[model samples]
Target chain A: MAFVVGMLIKTAAVPIVVAVVVTWLLHRLERLKPHAATLGVACGFIAGWFFQEFSVWFPVRYLDWFPAAALILALLPRVSPITAAWLLVPAFPKMVPPRLWAVGLLTVSTYGLAWFLNKATDKIQQRVIVGVFMATGTACSLVLLQSFSLKFAQIAGLLTASLTAALLSANKPYGNAKGLPFLFIGLMCNLMFIGYANTSSDVPTWCFALPLVAPLVLLWNPGSKKLQAVRYALVVTILMVAVIPALLVHPPWEAEH
Target chain B: MSRNILIICAMALLLTGCNSEEATNPSPDAGDNTTPETSSGSGFAVTSENTKVLFVGTKKSGDSQAGGFKEVSGTIGVDGDKITSVNVVIQVDSLFSDQDKLTGHLKNEDFFSVKEFPELTFASSKVEGSGEVTITGELNMHGQTGEISFPATVSVTDGNVKLDAKFKVDRTKFGMNYTGQPDNPINAEVDIEILVNAE
Candidate 1:
């Protein structure tokens, strides 16, 4: 029992529980409201920040703050743009002048890209875009965690994967059409920060590109009888392809001969 | 749609900018100018063949595991029975644990980050005491330096010196802060036993 409990904590059981509860809440909330996806994303962002503050898995630092701030801006652009912009103030003190400017620009641009992707005419396209973002973020975070031997990477990956699964399920034809791109943007930013911060060795350049490239597979729209199944299969295949190389290349455990 | 694809491609290209091997792997430095050059025919020379540096770390269960380095080289300046100075460098890559997996893990980024911090060095700032000697020095490891003091018994005979010391060092002080799991936590204080033979 002691060993089991230890393993559970090590595998990030807290984040898993949080993800399950958030997914259930999103499913229920979507039934009652039109902008339920936005609310759900906001909830997730808050949960991530809360966990970072209280849990050992997430570092309570500027890197974690930027993602939550970006999410707020994306989700509630009209209501919280100024407040969210203010949230980025914490990042300035931690970085040098040049780095602060570069990261600041990147954060704003990425948030813009997520906002643009959210405006897709086709529902499937929007879901696919969000899926790709989450999948890539998960893969990158996993690789970073594995490479650096960080326990928190597991929590980050679990949270992102859970959110992706929830988003994909919630956006089915009969389900709520509203998807959570803002949440994914925040998660991706967090994972990207982890990847950048944890990398101590020469990881293959292709590992970084795989997540971005995997979604291209979705462009092949097969008009089959089982169209939904094919799309799901394609998404899964893309994610697997993106993640496998990262696990294989310069694996953290491989000892130097 | 075409614009979206282009934007995503641009985003991917921008993310490529986030690739940072330099940030994680700090530039190696022989920190604080503590590594002193050994002059021939002056200071007593210490080599791998004549030195043994063993470290004992405890698990959360209070069980201790011992590990040692196969290679260490140093120089100790002596004036008669009084030790003047000492400079020792232990190869991080040369660590030998009872468990091979543990050895590999120790060399990884979680502990020594051997690729970045390949060597651990101790350069004595002051050496005092008559019979049982106390050496105060700056220990550099894992890109961090801290002052440390240890007591050792020194025995010199026929131009050969053998020094033995057992000391406790907090691994967290050197940035080695992985403390295992809650039920299986590793003790922060590592017991180190040093045996140096200089000729």
Candidate 2:
């Protein structure tokens, strides 16, 4: 009973309330309006703080603090959001041999995805489409990450909530990532870390990469709002069908608590 | 100087690989079949049947949950009927609770987080007195090591030894500060009971 209540508060109530409030506040300032999408990172920071200890010394154990650090990197006016990608450095999972090349590839890929997502969302309407897509990706992340780490999953939950509320209230708050050109890059960083942390899941590797194809939806420039919604549903449905369904079939005992 | 730094970074890159299947199998620290040693290596190995380690956690509303670790391996160092040292290693993944879901939740970050830090260890830093003994040691849990002192009873025979103790630990001190809800909060004080028999 206590566990259920704690999870509800940590993963549900606090995340939705914090994300919505932050989105509403950011929307109030004209200057900060453009950066409203960074709310996903902000909520992720909150969830991470609540879920994991900031005082620990181990490398991967320090991940709960990464969201806050990444948020700082993204929100700092003097720095590039791409700098948040450096989180991949501290995020090196000790359970494996250090893969420097893999880290480099992931960092570069995140930057590329950020750039591509930005270009895809240049228009206001396109921003909403990508925004919804980012939310969907976050929802997928919450599910997949739960199979291994709840801290990351809760972080994913906050991002999903923040994106959803931001999408509704601000029209297009999933506008940009922490300090970068795209929000999905931050989500990708989270998904990548979860993948590294995942050692017990039966879910295949490629399924983890399914949501990175958000830009593929941008390829079809829909002529009307109705068609765009259709495409959005089609894309998210396919991604959900591809990932969440198979993973849900697992009995609860198999999941890492 | 910059070139040397780059070389070092390159070297670091070569040394580390991506995470794999190591976490699936939880184990003690590599090469840590730690048997508490003395002049004669009097550390007696006890079977699970003869040993018991248990904990009871409560809610602010007064509800309680009890659990124990399934796999426990440790040694009680004895030097000629005098207890010298105590070492214990608990596999976090082996945690079991009265409720199955709570077992999983306890293993998650809200409690044990067995995925990252897989073992809880303790090594005696100070052992004082005899009979009714005060055992002071570093109790390492959830990656935070804290010096904890508890009282226990120690008895020794020719080839058999028995030790028993009960104590309280603040979960918050070990970094487990999950307050359940506004109405039903988790109590910080957790009751720990240990019984060790070696023959």
The A-chain TM-scores of all the candidates are 0.62, 0.72
True contacts kept of 1: 0.05
Interface RMSD, candidates in the order listed: 9.9, 8.0
Report lDDT (CA) for all predictions.
Answer: 0.58, 0.60
Estimate, for each residue in A182-253, the C-alpha lDDT of model 1 and write its tens digit: 445444544444344334434454454355444445445566759857766776676677566656655545
Cα lDDT of model 2 by residue, B41-155, tens digit? 4777754667888999988878888998877777888877778788887776788887655675677656776666678887887678887889999888876878999999999
lDDT of 2 at A63: 51
Where model 1 places Cα greater than 4 Å from the true spot, the runs are A1-122, A125-148, A158-212, A221-228, A238-257, B1-34, B37-41, B45-50, B69-74, B90-100, B115-119, B157-159
lDDT of 2 by residue, A167-237 (tens): 55544423433243344455455455545444344555555555666545665767898998887786777
| Best model number under TM-score | 2
lDDT of 1 by residue, B82-122 (tens): 66778888877788888655665576656776655677888
Best by lDDT: 2
Docking class of 1: incorrect
Docking class of 2: incorrect
DockQ each: 0.10, 0.13
Among residues 3 or more apart in sequence or in different chains, the pairs in candidate 2 whose N, CA or C atoms overlap within 3 Å are A37-A173, A74-A178, A74-A179, A81-A179, A97-B16, A97-B17, A98-B16, A98-B17, A99-B16, A99-B17
